[model samples]
Target: MRKLQFIILLQFSILLFAQENEMKWQEKQYPDSLEAVNKAPENHIILFENENLRLLKIFVAAQKSEPIHSHRWPAVMWVYQPSDYEQVFYTENEKAERIPVQTVAMKKNELPMNVGFPVGKGDLGLSKNLGNQDLVAYRLDFKKKIDSSKKITKPTGWTWNEDLDGVKKAPASHQIVFEDEYTRILHVVLSKGEEESVHTHQNPCLFWVVKSQPIEYSEFKMDKKGKLRKSKTHQLPPLPTDQLLDQNKISDPEPPHSVKNLGTENFEAYRIEFKK
Candidate 1:
C-alpha cells in the first residue's frame, strides 16, 4: 500500500512540471486564425484588430518568455508587471533604432502605457525579455478608421465678435470675416474694396473659398515666429463660384494679410487650421 501511494504522488509531480514547461516558448507561431497567441502565466490583456480598425482584448496565464514576432500596426501598450522600465526598438528605412527612453518612473503596481504612431513597413519583430519573475502587461491598440466625410466637413474657424457686419456691401477687395476658439477653422466673406479690421490669430488657421464671383482675392498670411506681428497681404486671381476651393492651392503661414476683392461680385471663403 505504501509503495502505491508514493508512485501516485510522483506521477502527479511529473504532470505538473510538464504543464509548466509547455507554457514556455522561444519560437513564434503563425496561426491561421486572426487572434492573439498568448501563453504567458501572467494576466495578459491584449487589444488587437484585423485589416479594419476594430479593437480586441485578450488575457491569459503565462510562464517563461517567448521568442518575438512581427506586429505591424499602430498600438498603445501598458506594462503591468515587473519594474516600470520598458523599451521599444524598430527599423526605419532599413535603419534600426530603439525608441527614446522613458525616464519617467512608474508607480508601484501601476500600469505603463505607450502609444506608437505608424511605422515603416520594413520594421519587423517585437519581444519582451523578462528577468527572473513572470511577465505581465496590458496592450491597447488604437486603429481609428479614416472617415472621408471628415475631410469635407472639417471646421475652419469660429465667428469672431467683429466678423458679423451691420452693413451690406458686395465688390472685390480684402476682408476679415470670422474668428473662434478653434484655431484651424475660419469663415471669411469678401466684398470689393473691403478692408479687415486689425486682429490677431495667435495660432494657425485655414481658409476655404465657398463663394466667389469674379473672385479676385488677397493672399492669406500669418505672422512670423513672433506673436502679434502684423500680417502681410498678397493678390490672387478670381476663383469660380461653381467649383469647390482646393485647400492645397494656398501657401501656409497665410495670416494677418488683408484681402481685396478684384471682381464684380462678392467672394466668400472658409479656412481651417490644425491644433497642436
Candidate 2:
C-alpha cells in the first residue's frame, strides 16, 4: 500500500508540472502583457514602446520554438526573411492545436509577403520555426483599439488623384505591401547610388529600417520649364526614428521628396503612412 501511494503521488506531480508549463502565459491575468518578450530578449526585442504603439523585432532560429505568449493589440508584421512555421494556439480550457502558417509571395506592386492580423485581447499562441533559415520580422502593435466605422481623412492641400504627373509617380523601389482604411504600408528597396522618382507624401508617414544604411533625402522643386528638379539633399541617419509622424508634426504642405541610397549595400525599409 505504501509503494502504491508513492506511485500515485509521482504521477500527480508530473501532471501538475505539465499544467504549469502549458499555461504560463494565461496565469499572468493581464490582457496587455508582453511577459514572453520581457523574459526572452534575444528572440523578441522591443525597439520602441509608447502610448500609441509598440514596435518589436523578433527572430526565431531554425527548428526552434518560442514560448507561448499573448498579444492583446492589433498588429502589422513585416517579414524580412521567409520561413515555414507552425503556430499553436491555446484556449481558456487549456486545449491547444497547431496550424501551419505558410509564406506566400505577393506581386511586384502589391503588398509584401507578410501578415496583418487583429489579435483580440488575451489571444495566446506559440510559433515554431520549421525551415532551415531563421525567421526575422518586425511587429507594430497599435495600443488603442481601432474603430472601423470612422473614415480615414485625406491629407490637406492634396487631391486623391493617383495618376498625377510630376510628384505623384512612385519609384520602382516602392511596393504597396498592406493597406487599410487607416494606414498604408510600403516596402522600399533601393540599391547603392540608386534614386527614387520624385514623389509626394500628402499624409503623415514613418518608416522602419530593415537593412540599416545611409540615405539621402531630397525635395523636388519645379524648374522654370515646369519640370521637377532635385533640390539640396539632406542625409538621413542609418536608423529610423521610433516615433510616428502625423500631419500636424510633418513640415510643409504637399511635400514632394525622393530618396537616394548612399550606402554600399541595399537599403531596405517599410514605410507606414497614416491615412487619417
Candidate 3:
C-alpha cells in the first residue's frame, strides 16, 4: 500500500508540472513598430505584445555575414538592408546552407526550420523565428487567459480613412496630400515634384514613413487671431518624430501644416491625427 501511494503521488506531481508548462505556452498578436523590434549583434528581432503582455508578432533583421540560426518561435520579419544573399540549410534537416532573398517588392515567404535569408540594399523580406538580435518590438500581452477556440487576427497594420466630417481633401488639395480617420490613421503618398499649399489639420498629428526615400518637409504654425504663423520643415527627422520607424502619438487639437515629396522616387507616409 505504501509503494502504491508513493507512485500515485509521483503521477500527480508529473501532471502538475505538465499543466504548468502548458500554461506558459501561450500565443498572441503584436503591434507594428520599431519598439517592437529586438536588436542583437547577430540579427534583429521584433516581438508583438498584446494588451496583456502576450507575445504576438515576431520579426527578424539580419546583415551580411550572418549565420543561419534556429527560430524557436514563429514570426514574420521584413528585411531592409542588403541586396543579394542566401538562406542555406535543410528545412527538414539541420545543416548550414544559403537561400536567396532577392525578389520583387511586396513579396512574402515563410521559412521552415533553420534557413539563411539573403538581403540587399533597398530589399525587404519577411521570415519567421530566425536571428538572435536583442531588438525591441511592439508587443501585446493578454491580461486574462485566452481560449484556444478563439480565432486571433492582426490589425490593418496601417490604413487610412476620411475624417469624421467626411472631408476627403484638407483646406487645400495641394496643402493636404491625403487625410483620413481624423481620430486614427491618415496616409499620404507624394510623387516626385509633388507639393502642397500651406494648411493645417483639425487636430494634432504625427507623420510616419511607410517606404524609403530622400524627402523634405515643412510646417507652418498659426497663432491666435490667425496672424502670427511660423514656417519650418526638416529633412527626414529622427524616426517616429519625423519619420515613424515604429510607434506614434498624436494629441488633440491637431496642428496644421503642408508637406512635399522632394525625393526622386514617390514618397509614402502615414499619419495618426487626433480628432476634436
Ranking the candidates on TM-score from highest down gives 2, 3, 1
Model 3 TM-score relative to the real fold: 0.34
* lDDT against true structure, model 1: 0.35
Go through the candidates in order and give the clash count of each.
Answer: 37, 2, 56
Q: How far off is residue 214 in model 1, in Å?
A: 5.2
Q: In candidate 1, which residue ranges exceed 4 Å CA deviation?
A: 1-184, 198-200, 213-234, 240-251
Q: Candidate 1's residue-wise lDDT over 1-276, tens digit each?
A: 765464445345434432332333112232322123343213333222334332222222232333332333333232323443222322223233333211222323442222111222112233343343444443333245344344323225632332322111212222322222322333356566666544433333333444664432233333475334343445566664323344433233332334556666566654433233
lDDT, candidate 1, at 246: 43
RMSD of each: 23.2, 13.3, 17.3
For each candidate, give its TM-score against the true structure.
Answer: 0.27, 0.66, 0.34
Model 3, C-alpha of 179: deviation from truth (Å): 12
Write one digit per residue (lDDT tens) for candidate 3, span 1-276. 875565445345434533442343222111122112322223442222334322222323433333333323322222222232333321211232224422222112321111111111111223333333322122122234435454323123312222312134443222232222322344455677677554444444444454556656675554687552557777763222233344423323333455666667766554444342
* Candidate 2 segments exceeding 4 Å error: 1-36, 39-41, 94-112, 115-119, 147-168, 223-226, 235-254
Error of 1 at 179 (Å): 8.7
